[model samples]
Target chain A: MSDTSANRRQRVQSAETGMSVLKALARLGGDASLTAIAAEVDENAAKVHRYLLSLVQEGMVAQNAATQHYHLGPESVRIGLAALRQCDPVRMGEMALVRLRESLQVTCFIAVMGNRGPTVLRIEEPSLPVTVNMRAGSVLPWLWSASGQAFLAFSDDADIRVQAQAEFDAGNEAQRSMLAGPDPVARLCRQVKEQGCAIVIDTLLRGISAVAAPIFDARGRVVAVLTALGASNGFDARPGGKVCPQVMREAATISHAMGFGPG
Target chain B: MSDTSANRRQRVQSAETGMSVLKALARLGGDASLTAIAAEVDENAAKVHRYLLSLVQEGMVAQNAATQHYHLGPESVRIGLAALRQCDPVRMGEMALVRLRESLQVTCFIAVMGNRGPTVLRIEEPSLPVTVNMRAGSVLPWLWSASGQAFLAFSDDADIRVQAQAEFDAGNEAQRSMLAGPDPVARLCRQVKEQGCAIVIDTLLRGISAVAAPIFDARGRVVAVLTALGASNGFDARPGGKVCPQVMREAATISHAMGFGPG
Candidate 1:
């Protein structure tokens, strides 16, 4: 690359590193010390401290005076609120999730393809309010989750495969041979695309299972993945299963509401 | 200020200026151009342009490929999601807003004192879903809206008075003599505190009225302000009106949920 372009690239890379510190704090449950944040991002503590100071000054993060731990600031909240409003997929999918949860007696969540992974955007629980880890803004990995597999299989983006491959490559060495080559993932994708849904049993978390379906927009583009999660013992993963079809129906409803149709 | 302190202050001010560009885009509904952002922040175009480029690179802002208009990025959404999960006032207050809307058959909202103004955090509408302009992330001035007035009156923070005074001084000539002095605002605050609610009629917007109450934490600090709003014709703003008492009751419920009281 040319010198100027290389310089620009370095600037952008540094900027992304700064953003990663913020994301690290978020991933660590929204409040952490500089040491923790640096360890999460695997960056130097002194550098992360400078970045945190700048972010705090910019109001993207705030440190509690008493505890001296940093969390996302009010401005980040406002910016996120704006992002949530601007994204129609999450907003429209919420009503469908609520309806599904009310009728299905299961916990339903919407996960969109965020930069890192399939990030949960909205969630609804049954009357009992089942204890589930999924929530809005949580990013679940693609290697072993219903929402991840659904998006991986059904999304039109060819880049999805590249991302999945990167994540798989980053996975532990022992797990690489479990699913074999790209053939396995491709075969599963074909099956999911044919059945119009994806199901996983105790994939990511023990004693929990999920069924999810791809949600498309007007142009038939996969915009999000909607899932129903519950205890593994009673939860069904069959395409013909009760909770499975409901998630697909909700996905179709949300997709239609998002302007996806016969056109 | 000493030379070192002066330099530190300038650096922090510059960082804040960069953040202002992001806030400006959020204020203008989360998509604007470099010129628009600079104009909104009242900074030079070159400086704001640099800020936008940096912000976009940081993933705090994103520019449309076609329009080149800047919008909040996914990272900002993630941070904001973290903020929403962390802030109990907005989250816990949501249940009260929903209950109030359902039981009272009106549109209810929660507004917290944001950096700029009284920012709406959540809104719940009745079964019919009332057509109201207010939404999450909207900032309402303290000098006008019911939620704003509630915060001004019931909040224990002395800075609240300073903020109100600053806004009043910046107001146009007509509004200056309208509230007369701090005594009038003080008296209104006293009445609101005494009644545990605040009401406004045909003040901020035409044909609209509202009633609001403060949500306090365990320390008795005002955390949020809850308000019910509708058309002036059918909407009652009377102290003993149907919606007024219910709002106060709901506010009390939310305050309790927020961990208010010795019990």
Candidate 2:
């Protein structure tokens, strides 16, 4: 029994080492040498080299003869894009947000309810001085701002909300109470249903006003939220700023295209 | 010697099998069970299971407990996006094309000289009834389309042009002779140098016209081309429809942003 337990521990450690190598390569932006990878993972070069060789043999890693550097092979991108496409909510919302950023000349984003809170899956910014620089994979908590509210309003999973509330409560009791008041999710849901949009003022970033709407799938399930953000000053200057209605309409258009019914 | 050669052959076969499994998972949109992956790759489930265990241990694959299926892990996207950022020329050109499509409500594309010919890297279309549906990754031979001509005109690589000519010559003598006249690349370079743009009408896609300009890097090398494509009827109807100066201006704007010299 002692021997079996020791073997299992060794196996687990080996698995962790393999995972560390993949993560180190990933964090290096898919391009790294064995030495660099070893340094990153704080492992011996010989050990990392063996792992890399195995990955290369598996076609997940390819070494360029000219550069003598390892890169994530074409198969990596192929799989990554495929996985992204499977998340129909994020994919469709990103496409629509791309169009919206073009039309409105503002920063657009798609956020989803993640384990932590709202995770920004996509961001499109116009060539403007005041443009936001947020990109994909950025996570923010629920009490931070509008994106959080938009996500909370549309998410149908009660357990997820409970989890999010517990996290929020642990972090900031005042903000959690404010967020929990009058059943915020229920009220926001009714507003989203009635107005087909959510207007958030100074909720997330200071002086950054935004308009957002829930993105639904073919099953009328809210999968994501689309938001356009910019400086609060002059936000309502141009017909309530081109982004608000435009974002709402674009979200609706995307939702419709995804086979969702009208609000 | 025979035993050594057989061992090497087996290794290659295993690598190929691994690649096939990866491709199958990508085609399945990044989620697959061992059985599904085995069926897709025409392999035994046991063989595929071992490969999957390796992948999972590496954190390249994550299993959904509810579905008991595997999908691409977040690490994949991190690497892919990093690879994308390093290829900044493609991203810069794509952003310009996205802007042009939004502003003009026309079809815009970015094409680069690939091994075969001109490959479409990105395509942005206006939300219109007659929008073009040209997919990304579609390759077309050089000397057959406006994008090809644009790329040829700006390319400094002599071998690429020679190879492109050889490909053109392999088809028909008459077509080769037509393409051979006046060194299209030289003329295009001169025209782009003087006017900062290139316009081609019915040269590639029938009933479609295009105006393109070279985008230069900070080092002043032409890294990519920005193009605006539209219906020939509409193009011609709008004042020298085949020669829209505004399209050229937009391309120049993108080039300037990309650190090109004055148009």
Candidate 3:
């Protein structure tokens, strides 16, 4: 690279390093000493201290005088809540998940297409011994599960597709083949449109199956995907997954309630 | 100031400028061009552009190809969410508000003591026509509200008291008097503890009456204040204000659920 290019690259690297330091402190539950943050991010302690002090001055991080350790300040929470306020998907999907879990006695989840891939935004697990135990904020590949397929099917945005493809390719070789195709997403979209749902039988986890449907916002834009997760063993044996159709209908009802429509 | 002090002051000014730029972008809902950011923050366009470029490289801001305007990047949301996840007050208080709203048939809120004053962490409005309409993130004075009184009553920590008092004194002269005392907070705490709740009549909004009880965490630390809000005109004149007893009971239940005890 040219000298100017190298300088630009170094500047970007330094910026990324600083951002990484902030992320490290955040991931440590918003409290970390300079030495601890440095160890977590594998950076120089003195440099980390400088970055932390700057954050403290900006009111994004607070240092306890007695412990000399940092925690997230109110300003940080304010910023985060601002972003969350913009997310209509979480607002619309939470109540739907609650209702689905109550009626079906199964786990319900809402997953959104993230910059990296598909991420579970919320999960509502039935208070049953046999319920699925997935947590919110968990990331999954675009091709590995039913919720991912449902999200990809309804998501027509080109940027999301490209990013998802790139992330899928960066995974293991075996995972890459599962996600590779000239028009895999388009094909999935067609299937979802035809079936009105995406069903996966043990694609991600053995003996686990899920049926997912897309959720839309007032603008008819796909905002999220709602999925009912259950065991595959007795699914077909019991009423062809008796709850699947009801769950799909409930998902559609929620989408319509949020102002999407087949009406 | 000495020459070294001047240099330090200059650095602080630059840092403040950087933070101001970021805050302006955030207040604008995380999307703005350099020109707009400059106008919003009252900075030079070129200098704002430099700051925007730095933020872009740091992954705190991203420029849209179509609009060329900056938006909050995924990394910024990630950082914010990480900070929110550490806020035990919000997490515990949100659940309590949910239950309190269900039980009381009135608006419920959770406010935390902060440097700026008392900040509402969550609000759950009842599904009634005359219910309170306060937003979740609204900030209020620490000396004039039931939430503030509850915080003062339950919190024995010195640092929180100092921060809350500084914020209370920074208000208008009339408001400042509410916080003035050799031990204003101790008196407030005593009243709240004796009454088992704090009643704020027309202290915040005119014609608004509120009662708040404290929420404590597993370690007996006061984490939040739960309040029931209603219009003052008919609140005491009707059976609706009976919600106060339920509100106090539910608040204690929630505090107990979070591991606080009477002792």
- The numbered model that scores best in DockQ is 1
Q: Write the per-residue lDDT of candidate 1 for residues B141-183, one digit (tens) a residue.
A: 7767888889999876788777777877787775655576557
- Tens-digit lDDT string for candidate 3 (B79-169): 6666655657665456567776676566778887666667887778878735444776787665677887777667777765776567666
Model 2 lDDT per residue over A1-263, tens place? 12355334333344445546656776786788888999999988876776666556554566655567876654454555554455466654656777877776767788877766678887888788255546788876544556766666666778656755565657655455545556665655566556666676666566777777777764567777887877888565232456667877788765654445421
For A1-263, candidate 1 gives per-residue lDDT tens digits of 12365446434344456567777888787788888999999988877776777677666786765577887766666666666567577765767777788777788888888998899978888878657776789998776888998999987677888877777778776445545655667877887888889887776778888899988864477889999988888777778978887888888876754445421
DockQ of each: 0.16, 0.09, 0.10
lDDT tens digits by residue: candidate 3, A1-263: 12365446434344445556676887676788888899989978876776666666666676655577777665565555444445366654566778777876667788877766678888888776354546788887666677877777777777766765665667667655654468666665687667777787777777787888888754467778888877777554122457657767777765654435422
Q: Chain A of candidate 1: what's the TM-score? A: 0.62
| Candidates in order, interface RMSD in Å | 8.4, 11.4, 10.2
If scored against the real structure, what TM-score would every candidate get? 0.40, 0.37, 0.40
Output the better candidate (1/2) by DockQ: 1
Task: Give the Cα error of residue A138 in candidate 1, in Å.
Answer: 33
Ranking the candidates on DockQ from highest down gives 1, 3, 2
What is candidate 2's lDDT per residue for B64-153, written digit by digit as tens?
555778776544445444443343556445555666777677787777666667777878877782445466887865565666666666
Clashes of each: 1, 3, 0
Candidate 2 clashes between residue pairs 3 or more apart in a chain or in different chains: A145-A203, A145-A204, B235-B241
Is candidate 1 or 2 superior in lDDT? 1
Count residue pairs with overlapping backbones in model 1. Answer: 1
